[model samples]
Target: MPTFTINGISATVPDGTTILAAAIRIGVEIPHYCYHPKLSIAGNCRMCLVEVEKFPKLQIACNTVVTEGMVVRTDTEKIRKAVTGVLELMLIHHPVDCPICDQAGECGLQNYYMKYGLHKSRYDLEDKVRKKKVQDIGGMIVLDAERCILCSRCIRFLREVSKTCEMEFFQRGDHSEISIFPGRKLDNYYTGNLADICPVGALTNKDFRFKCRVWFLSSFDSVCTGCANGCNVLADFKGDILYRLKPRRNDAVNQTWMCDFGRLEYRKANEARLLVPVLRENGKAAAAAWEGVLSTTALRLRDIADNEGPDAVAVIASPRSSNEELFLAKKLAAEVLKTENIGFTSRTPGDRTSDDFLIKGDKNPNSTGAQLLGITEEGFGRVVKAISDRKIRALLVFGSELSDFPDSQVEALLSNVPFVAQVGTNEGVVSRVANAVLPSASFAERGGTFTNFTGRVQRFSQGFPPRGKAMNEIEILAGLANRMGADWKFDGEASVFRALAASSAPFAGMSYESLGSEGQVVAEGRK
Candidate 1:
């Protein structure tokens, strides 16, 4: 351990900790660029200069490792002068496009200028060097060379993190600017991260460009359900619509990067959503009130369970559902409906589309969670076979579509079943064939836990309300259980999770509050 004093505050930290990191540890703010913790330290940006006791000149805090008895000052007049000089030089040729820039509210250069350099510009606005305004880079990123500060964060991320070396600085001196090769464009699975690390308006996501100001959006810590990796993410929503999904720093899972597929998953929450309940009348699906649909479906299911026996009914749970939703679905089938033909199906397309990075072969995010809840692979096969054999007269599905099953098998199954009730966030093939379609909240609009492929039980909070008449899966299940004469009570996701933890051995001793934003890993044997 090394002892260092940052602004009269003494602290001991491990060796090799940089002065910028040490200052941060002691609540000393050091303005910086090109110093991402996960990316390689490129000390090209001189914004983080700090004064040391015995140093002849200000040292770049990012590359300066702390030493025993080292004293550092970040708020001195000399350091402020140096930082102001650095910012002035960086802003000399930079264009004044803050009014039209997408990163106006969160740009690092704008924030640093307000903090360090609040003086009049020495150069005329007409003298600013003109560069390309908007270049359509591949992989959902737009480049504006005029707003770039040349921090090298995007370049380092492409080279070191994504390993896609498609960009570099061209020319020398003041004329230098970031550009791609003549024929090459920035195209990678993780290319969206370039805009995330750019710090300035130079690089921006094409999908989210000029959609909404960053300050107007409310953010919630959540997890990506694009794959079983369950990468941590921040969901940004405004006016009941999800605007974007950014990767949140979770060193245990996705270090500061997420695949572009997961980053764009928020669009589904805004588009093509199921908003209301529908029921079949005269062979046509029509919108119906929630009370009418729920009461009718409950009566129909009760009749089948009484006359045809519980074995004639089948429940198909989806791997896309959360752990709490899966637990309640299991309880609804086994305890309430008294059916033994309950199982879950995976939505994984194939292993060929998977990569060595965050994208997993298993497309479903909570398959491991479904498995822990006693929903087995063989059980799903048996249920499907029973449906095809015409032994199952009634069917209940959660979040899965008819595409998850074989086309020929599910078509026959759907034709034979007299009553099919489906709950999903989107209107798909299953919902079309189902006699009753109940709209359920999407992952972004619900709060629950998801167990990743490695048995990590991460929890996510609701970012917005469900679309239209859609309800959360937990509430829908609890309503159904109560209608069936069961006394199951659930106020919200937390209460349901507590009850699940109390009943299941794997989830025992775990609570929703205990599973923080970072998540806790369940033991391997339990999985």
Candidate 2:
């Protein structure tokens, strides 16, 4: 351990810890750029200057390792002047268009200007060096050369992290700018991270360029359900609309980076949605009230199980649902529906290709949770065979899992099955095939936990309310369970998780309080 004094505060940190990191640990702020913890240090940005005792000149805090008994001063008059000078030099050639830049409220230059550099401009707009602006760089990113601060964070990220060396510095000194090399452009699925690492408006996301201001959007900690990797994210929304999902730092999962596919998954909560419950009438589907839908659904399932047999009913749970929701679904099938013939569909309905970085090939976030809750993935074919044989008197399907089946086969099963009910988030094949369609909430509209591919259980909160007459899976399942003569009660997701922890052996002793922002991995040593 290295003990040091920073701004008159004594602190001890691990060996090789930088002054900037030590300051951050002790609740001190040292302004910096181009010094991301994940990327290699480029020491070009001298904004984190600090005064070390017995040293003639100030040193940059980012690359300055703290030695034992070393004295550091970050809040001195000398540091303030040095930082101000560095900020002025960086801003001399930068554009003054913060009003139009999409990174307005969150830009590093805009924030540092208010803190350090308020000096009157010594050079006018015409006197500053000019560079290219609004160059359409490949991979959903727009580049403005005039606003780049020559930080080289984006350039280094490509060379080191993504291993796709497409961007580089063009000229020398003030005329230098970031650009893709000739005859090549960014063609990777991880290009969206370039905008996140850039400290200024040089690289902006084309999908979210002018949509909404950062000040108007509120952020909530969430886990991405795009795949089994379960990358952490910050859901940015306003009112009932989710604008974006930015990567949240989780060292065990996605460390401050997510693929482009996961970034756009938020659109499912905002567009082409199902709003109300629809009941089949005279071979036609019609929008109906929740009360009638629940009662009718319960009556049909109960009468069939009592008449034909427990094996006459089948359930197709979804891996896209949460742990609590899946537990309730399994309970609804075993206790109320009284059938061991319950399973979830294994084949997903997306681009199943994955990379070595952050994406997973399963394309489902909760398959591990579904399996832990006693739902088999191999029974989809058996359930389909039962429906084909006309032995399934009543069928319950969650999500649009049937949509991934062959259209001719799906239609034949829907026609042969006596009664079909679906709980879906959006209108797709289920709207046409199922005899009754119940609207359920998307991932962003409900709060629950999802177990990733490695058996790591993470918690995500609801960012949007259920649109129109839609309800979450827990509420809808509980309603049907009670209507079917099964006594069930749950206050919220917390209570449901508590119930899940008690019943499931793998998730024996865990709660929402224990699984805070960063989640706890399931399996061994989880007390």
Winner by TM-score? 2
Candidate 1's C-alpha runs over 4 A off are: 348-352, 403-412
- Worst ten in a row by lDDT for model 1: 345-354
Query: Tens digit of lDDT per residue, candidate 1, span 314-431?
Result: 8999898889899999998999889999988675433325788788877788999999989987888898789878888888888746534565556567888889999888866677
Clashing pairs in 2: none
* Per-residue lDDT over 1-527 for candidate 2, one digit per residue giving the tens place of the 0 to 100 score: 99999988999999999998899889889999988888988999888899999889998888999999999988888889989999999989888889999889999998999988889988888888888888888887989989999889999889888898899999897888889898887978888899998899999999999999999999888889788899999999999888888899999999889989999989988887888989997888889999998889888999999999889988889998999999999898888888987888757666787889898888888988898888987777788778788889899989866736776767777788888899988777666777788899988889999999888899999887888888988999999999999889997789999999998888987887799888988877431
* lDDT against the true structure, each candidate: 0.87, 0.87
Error of 1 at 72 (Å): 1.1
Cα shift from native, residue 322, model 1 (Å): 0.9
Q: lDDT score of model 1?
A: 0.87
Backbone steric clashes in candidate 1, count:
0
